[model samples]
Target chain A: MTYWDQEKECMARDNLEKLQLRRLKETVFRSYAFVPAYRAKMDAAGIKPDDVNTLGDLQKLPFTTKQEMRDNYPFGLFAVPMSEVVRIHASSGTTGKPSVVGYTRKDVDTWADLMARALVSAGADKRSVIQVAYGYGLFTGGLGAHYGAERLGASVIPASGGNTQRQILLMQDFGSTHLACTPSYALFIAEVMHDMGIDPAGLKLKAGIFGAEPWSEQMRTEIENKLYIKAYDIYGLSEIMGPGVAIECPFRTGLHIAEDNFLVEIIDPVTEEVLPEGSLGELVITTLTKEAIPMIRYRTRDMTTLSNGECPCGRTHVRMQKVLGRSDDMLIVRGVNVFPSAIETVLLGIPGVEPHYMIILERQDNLDIMEVQVEVSEDIFSDEVRKLEDLHKRIAKELESNLLISVKVRLVEPKSIPRSEGKAVRVKDNRKI
Target chain B: MAKQISVFLENSSGRLAHVTRVLGDAGINIRALSIADTSDFGILRLIVNDPDHAYKILKDAGFTVSETEVIAVRMPDSPGGLADVLDQISEENINIEYLYAFLGFAGGDALVIFKVEDIKKAREVFEKKNINYVEAQDLYKL
Candidate 1:
């Protein structure tokens, strides 16, 4: 019922946009002056700091992508000197090189307040026992939630992650009312509790702030039903002030983006064109007050729809739907942008073709070749060779027309494609470039 | 009503050999076999001693397989044997999708497996035309 920063959270649209304009100008000026990488990019785009006259001028600035962050690497993008920056965090870099980010002392304070605001919105207060279980160390989740809990005057429990049985025991004995963890880990803890024959009703857990991974509403219901606690979806990336970028309030509608700190924009992932409100697209955020890393229009690649409708909870900050998918998987083949999901949609519509497929990209004679390997399932099988060949040709033609790139369709043996445990690797890029 | 076993195989090497090995492991003897192929894939159709068992084993081995009712006609092992059968089938207006030879000459008689559009009509035509076809039990014995 109460907001951590009521004035900023419930500001009028004009006032919020005014504040955003001011912060955007300051952030652009600072990045242009201090960060060489950003200055060059802005200069290349033929834009100056004063070119940003209004909030709408954000579209004119050059977009920053993960590749840009990767290029910057350790301290190349830092706006402040190392001495002024207090803490540093690096992503696990599960794909390539780990991206590192630094936080100035004041940036750290701003992050803590943002996280605190997020926690309070998700029904945590000073009297609550907040268990931060989103991992510690270089991962921003654990310390991010921990510092926020401390700032809220809540009893802090730095449980980190893993050790499911121990997490349950602490929850039971310590009387923790609020939990901050990844949604999957929260379910694991519930499973361990069920196996131990412990009743969730006996514990005092009220809600869980779950993030770091995209989850479905069904999983939220499963966690809520099994753990007997309300589950909230929190979203953030290590590149963008960690776990406090946005969080779902008790209203359970959408995660309210902390617009005061981070300016949010939804853009078409293909054209990189800004989409109108409520249209589903990629989320691009610009860090407004982050002095250590004043990211100017950093493309988050996260796909979500935005809503500017007034929330019943009275938080006037812009709200983003739970992340739908990642545009990071968007592939550019022969000057044509293709989404595997679009191809998948086409695959499902065609009869006799299974939805299971893998997109393989290889460079041939300096041209990008995309080959889709589809399983020859029994449904599409025939004793006549020409029929099966027709099936192959049809699939290839369909993919080519839908993706606007020539595709070679190969039918492999049933269940021959290598499958992974979670989030199956749909695309394999063998290009040496 | 003999049953023909059809297995889908990819163009990748060793896929055909792997399927043969699986059938061999199951001790399923191939009475007759034929392959219809394209550059991308092939459908290996076979008349085996036990078609149901072949279908099960090939499916268990993760190969896409299917079964269709086919008639194996036994005639004298001569130059005109297949021609005579083809003439009779053409007179009956039965469109044969495909046909393949048996593994070996069975007692001076040859067997040819035919996949037709209509099984019941083809079998009825064979009966009226006095064409002697190998029974399902007799094929299993061979």
Candidate 2:
């Protein structure tokens, strides 16, 4: 358990807060002074850099959002000149225009150091061979993990996303010890390995850092069992700092955030007010050390809670639970709020239900109807129609009792659900309204 | 005990066509077929010349196929032929889950497939009542 930066990682809580405050003030002042878009926003809200004397004053600043990023488009909120910006990454922007994020030379270095700390916490060392399977180029996952693994002095194989067979071959031939990719992609890779007849035990893969999509703990167990590796949940977005914002330690406990670099707050998404510690709500982050684009209180839309205590790993940073689901992913069906992850938890516990599912929402008679189409795998399929119907009823019954909402369970053909190379599409809203 | 191939099919178009194409390509002839469908999916019950072969090919083609035991009976080809056969079974208190028509091996007679609640007991009643039913091997040769 050698720390990447033992002094910074294990600093006292009071000292870390002091460091965060200093960086917060500098980031506030720089954003107000260099970026006019942020300055106008602050002026409209009656907030000045000089007024942010304490950390709690962070709530006074207007929150930046994903929609604001797209409105700014490209680089409207960059706090530094283009000469200092050395790297750029944009989210896939499943909606319309991609939200762009820039990294200055110093910001990129800070990102690499933060990612290295995350990797170290998740049990990586200079001797480890890390295979970064995340997509490179405009997507932050690939290059983010690449630089972090390199910073940790570990051997990095830049095996970007999508060549599943070749990735498996390289993972075996290169003696890769760690894999970095989305959890859904990792599951698909495991499926490919099964088809390729490549035994996971025959490979040197040890642990996996999976993020970029919300997944359940049962999903983690499936990946761990399928790949024969420890699956660590990582939390990050390009709006924040890609795949290294926070990650679970080797103990598989809550994810530890680098408090010195990022300030985390859980806020009620509806009221937009910060909640007390350990309350699950939408995550809002204020980057304290980023140089290229100093985001002030960015509403991440991810739902999770923060807990403060000394981790067994000896780090004092606050830990966030594995994200429940994005507020944007929550579906309101028939007046009952439902999280797709809740449906996933139910599906995972039942037999004959594969992890592949698609939630189709429709409006009939001006009422919301949620139909969960579950893939029928070879194991769950039966020639007996009654048996198959019973499985379908079981899923629907369990979902309604568990989620307290009436759900329609549809048994789909085996492998009928479509999966993208990136995040798997879990929901499809077909309501014209 | 006769083997009938039961395949799970989605109600989406072309799936049934695909299954039939796969079985036809394998040189398996459909002797008798019945489809039980819902709004979302269907169960295509098939009585074929080669039940084992049809099941294997459909399974390989990625269709969820299964084999179940059903009784094939040779009844009179009159208007009341089905009623007479079903009346005797009802008299013995045997519950028939479902029954479908099938092509007969010979002319002037009708072949019926019976999926009942109690198959072994049905066989006993059939034997005691002097009913004519095709043997499992004889039915597969149709």
Off by over 4 Å in 2: B1-4, B47-56, B66-102, B106-140
- What is candidate 1's lDDT per residue for A59-131, written digit by digit as tens? 9999988888789888899999899989999987757888899999898899899999999999999999998
Q: Write the per-residue lDDT of candidate 2 for residues A1-433, one digit (tens) a residue.
A: 6788999888998899999999999999999999999999999999989999999999899999999899989899888888988998898887889999999888889989989988888789999999999988898899999999999999999989998999999998999999999999999999889867899999999999999989998899888989999999888899988888898987767998888889989999999988999899999999988888888999998999899967888888899999999998888887777899989989999865678899999999998888999887767866556777888889999999998988898888766788656788899899978
Q: Which candidate number maximizes DockQ?
A: 1
TM-score of 1: 0.64
DockQ, model 1, C-alpha based:
0.57
* Regions of candidate 1 where Cα sits further than 4 Å from its true position: A1-63, A75-96, A101-237, A241-262, A266-282, A287-294, A301-332, A362-368, A429-433, B105-107
What are the per-residue Cα lDDT tens digits for candidate 2 across B1-142? 7998888788888998999899889999889988887777888899888888888787667676778889998988989988988899999999987889996544678999999889999999999988889898888777
Best by lDDT: 2
TM-score of chain A of 2: 0.97
